[model samples]
Target: MLYQIISFVLEVATSLFGGACLLRLYMQHQRVPFGNPVGRFVFALTDGLVLHLRRVVPSTGRWDMASLVGAYLLKLTQFGLLWLLAGGLAAVGWVPLLAVFGLVQMAISGLTGLLIVYAILSWTQAGSPLSAVIDRLCAPFLAPFRRILPLVGGIDLSPLVLLVVLQVAAMVLASLQQSMLR
Candidate 1:
């Protein structure tokens, strides 16, 4: 029970911090001002870690290395706590399949976050700074789809396509992880 609680808290922290870091980095890329309250809050929450990482991980071309590193580290920490919890379950003769399950859960969470951002961008017509940030963050993922789909009747379907793709990826990852556990 204690292990489960610890793992849950760790997962929440990792997701929130990592998501904020990613959003901030995307906003920077989109040239959105960080002077606003939302921007300031995100900066305050992640600046310390991102600033430290900036020295070691310089930006490569257009990519924000610090943000990627922060997200990866957050995922790693979440995975670690999950592994620990799985081990605890195994000790009690519970199913030893939880580690893989935890991984799938984390991946799904990440994909869901991306989808939410994409949805907000599409719905708001990219008006809000948050929407602009999301647009930038999702550009790499949506670029190919946009080229293929294009805008029909002035309605962009890229968001729909992207959401479907994300869902499929999440499902595939979950299936693969479950298979590994078996």
Candidate 2:
């Protein structure tokens, strides 16, 4: 019970901040302006760590290395703490490997969430700023699928397809993690 509670708290905290770092990285990659609410929220959550890490992790060609490293560090911390709590019985060396998998899983989950929000906003609030931001973010991910799938009866199905792909990726990730651990 105590372990569960601690794990839950750490997961929530890591997701909130680590996910923000990842979002910041993506937003920068997409050349999205940070003046909007989503950007502001991401900055608020991640600025401290990302800014400090920037000294050590330099950005290269549209990729914000600091933000990526920040997210990875958060995952490392989360897994490291959990490993300690788990009585250090398992393969301790796998903590870093698990952290990498967790970071990828988190990115997959975040994209999945953004797709859902994009769909919802498309249906109910098409022209809002938030909707526009989400649309821009989703566009790159959806473009290939949209090109191949096309619209059905004037409704986009790419997000559904992308969601399925992400699920499969998650499953693959889990299997890979297990294999690597073993």
Candidate 3:
């Protein structure tokens, strides 16, 4: 019970900040301006860790490596604490692997979420600034699918296809993690 509670709390905290870090990286990669509400929120949530990491982890091309590292660090801390709570010292060596798995899972989950919001906004609030921001973010992920799948009855199906792809990726990642742990 205690472990569950701590794990839940840590997962929430890690997901919030770690998701922000990932969002920051994607926003920068998309060359989206960090002046809107979502951008401000992400910057507020991640600036401390990201700025500190920026000193050591320089950007590669347009990618914000520092934000990516920050997200990984956040996942590492979460898995490390959970390992400690479980008193699994014998398997402590797997903590880093678990962290990597967790980070990938988080990325999958985050992209899933972003796509959901983008789809919703497209249907209901297509002209808002936030919608534009989301459209830009979703474009790269959806482009290949869009190229292959034309609009069905004038409605874009790229989000649905992308969501399905992400789910499959998540399942495959889970299997890999389980096998690696074994």
Candidate 4:
């Protein structure tokens, strides 16, 4: 029970931090002003690790290497926590199979983040401050898709296509994780 609680807490922390890092990367790519409330919120959430990582991970070209590394490290920490929880389960004489579950959870979180970014952009188009903030925060991820997809008949379908691709990738990752557990 204690291990489960700890794992859950850690997982949430990892996801939030990772999501914030991704958002920062998105903002940097979009050239958005980062002094607003939403930007401040994201920065506050991730500043600790990001500040430390910035010294070690230099930016290359247009990419924020620190944010990418931060996200990956967050995921790895979540994985490690889940692995520890699995061990705890084994100590309790239960079948320890949480690693795959953790991977699935992480994948779902990532997919949800993508969807959220899409939704925010959509809402921004409809004129909302929060949406605008989110749009700026997610611009990096959407830009490539937008360029590849373009607009059709005055409607943009990049988000839809990207969502589909993200979902499919999530499914594949989940399947692979499950197979590894087995």
User: Which ranges in model 3 have alpha carbons more than 4 Å from their true place?
Assistant: none
- lDDT digits (tens) for residues 1-182 of candidate 2: 99999999999999989999999999999999999999999999999999999998999999999999999999999999999999985678888888999999999999999999999999999999999999999999999999999789999999999999999999999999888777
lDDT tens per residue, model 1, 1-182: 98778877986887678777776666676676787755888899899889999999998776777976776677666665666666654443223344335444555566567767677667666677666655665777778988999788998788788778777887887787668656
lDDT for position 13 in model 1: 86
List the candidates' TM-scores in order.
0.67, 0.97, 0.97, 0.68
Using lDDT as the measure, which candidate wins?
2
lDDT of 1 at 130: 66
Error of 1 at 151 (Å): 5.4
lDDT of 4 by residue, 1-182 (tens): 98778877887787777777876776776677788876898789888888899998999887887887787777666666666656644543212234334444554566567566657668566476667676554565568998888689988777677777777877877787668655
Q: Report lDDT (CA) for all predictions.
A: 0.70, 0.95, 0.94, 0.69
After superposing candidate 1, which stretches have Cα over 4 Å from the reference? 28-32, 36-38, 85-111, 114-129, 150-154, 180-182
Model 3, 26-58: lDDT tens digits are 999889999999999999999999999999999
Q: What range of 10 consecutive residues in model 4 has the weakest lDDT sum?
A: 91-100
Error of 3 at 132 (Å): 0.2
The 10 consecutive residues of candidate 3 with the worst lDDT sum are 88-97
